[model samples]
Target: MIPSFLVPLMGGSDVSPSLLTFKSLCYFKCSMFFSPLGMVPVSALVGFGLFDRGFPVVGHCVEIEIPMLILFIVLSQYLKNFKTRQLPILERFALLISATVIWAYAHLLTASGAYKHRPELTQHSCRADKANLISSAPWIKIRYPLEWGAPTFDAGHAFGMMAVVLVSLIESTGAYKAAPRLASATPPPAHVLSRGVGWQGIGILLSGLFGTLTGSTVSVENVGLLGSTRVGSRRVIQISAGFMIFFSMLGKFGALFASIPFPIFAAAYCVLFGLVASQGLSFLQFTNMNSSRNFFVIGIALVLS
Candidate 1:
């Protein structure tokens, strides 16, 4: 299952979904603690796809999303073939480039008043100027531990989160296994896997202390990005973590990204998530599909899922 590792915000709301993937991560920081107490209902509504106002807005976004999806595919394929040692940046950051171009295109439409007379939902979602989030957001804000209030624990919530943690463990296993294969590295040994899971658990515990609703998990979309860009550098992830830490405190910076139209993000997910699913299926080639036992195992796994 593709875990919505973070809450899906409508002011809402993915690898080749990676174009805006990083942006969304940062956006999460803006409201990281805003609705901590409201998480259960919000998560339930999102899981059920029952957003009262967001559904119509999301529908309006498809017009923008479809074109963005096409652009991602075209740019990714074109960059793959146009590789060169001196100009490798294009291929390494192809997803970002596609996202920027399409984002600008969407912004242009908003600036040109193309969405001016559209329905309110379309205007709210499709028009970049409508949100005015940047002006309203503080320039900088420091997030302190337990800033929302002292963390509370309940048996019901604890049990529900335990269920999510179990699923996250399974998802993390797939991501950890897949990442090395994509990067052309050996699979992780059991000890390394155990260490990774330990760190992830620590991260989750820290998120609770720091007032965020969710903990970190292996990002399947990022694994797909590694396969798509073919740039597997640990230093890159380290540098990004540094940036995430620094920019997360910049309230205006996070809010600016939070204002990005949801449809644009949806488009990116179409490409990145597809790559993730394709990569998962690619593993089947390594298995003995012809064997009855293998088929039975696959069938049972599918049914259970």
Candidate 2:
């Protein structure tokens, strides 16, 4: 999964159309998809993660989340009457504009002299969640011993800790909803059903067994995007995938993306993530907010978010 802030940027790369297909399928595509203010929470958390965890950790975006997610979204289509929306023109327009800008920026960033450093992200071993798995709280001790070693499960080094698999699963689930929402539609693939989710569990175990598993197939924001957009065509998403594979081998391409100034990336992400947050809030509008429980829920959401 990409960091909440970085998603807007990293997502912009490759065949833009295909990228949308994949993101729309992500459990949550945009942090702001639910609340126009959601970016506040999304950005804050990611910013907090960056400071608390570090950049590589914050910038990390795993390709692994796609296959596993597509498998699930394909089956979600089976649930009937799950759709809602008047297809707000503004939301649709906003979603396209926001995603395009970020995608374009990603292409530009990689096009220039920036993407020259194509160090394989897979080669380096990182701490659990890259740094997010740890915190500053002195009393907060890590109970999982699996996190203590390097990721060389097959090479004598231990495979990644079990926690990575656990956390990644949760996040990817979230991503499935986020991506489509940003586009102002419900994801498609009518065969989608609860039974399909079983594939994800299988993936989780295999990742552990192989020690190469990383990234969440579902994330809150990634899925949120899909809930908003309703576009879930895997074939369309292949375009972006083609570019991504090429970029992986071409250091210059990836570096170009890494070139944009932090300020620019921040501003761009702020818009996208903020939109994502609003979508979340809009979804909440369906609930009875007058109740204290709901009131408290909204209140806490505002305070923390």
Model 2: lDDT equals 0.37
Worst lDDT run of 10 residues, candidate 1, spans 9-18
Q: How far off is residue 193 in model 1, in Å? A: 1.5
lDDT scores in order: 0.60, 0.37
RMSD of each: 12.0, 17.4
Q: How accurate is candidate 1 locally (lDDT)?
A: 0.60
Tens-digit lDDT track of model 2 for 1-305: 32233223322111122223333434433222444233333323322322322222324433222222232233333322343374444333433444344445544544562435645452122111222212322322223312433222221111232334334433333333345555555642323412223345444433433333352244333333344345556664577568765665555445544443333323333333444445545545456656787667556755673
Q: Tens-digit lDDT track for model 1 on 216-281? A: 677666776887788889999999999988888898888877877777766665555555555555
Give the best candidate by lDDT: 1
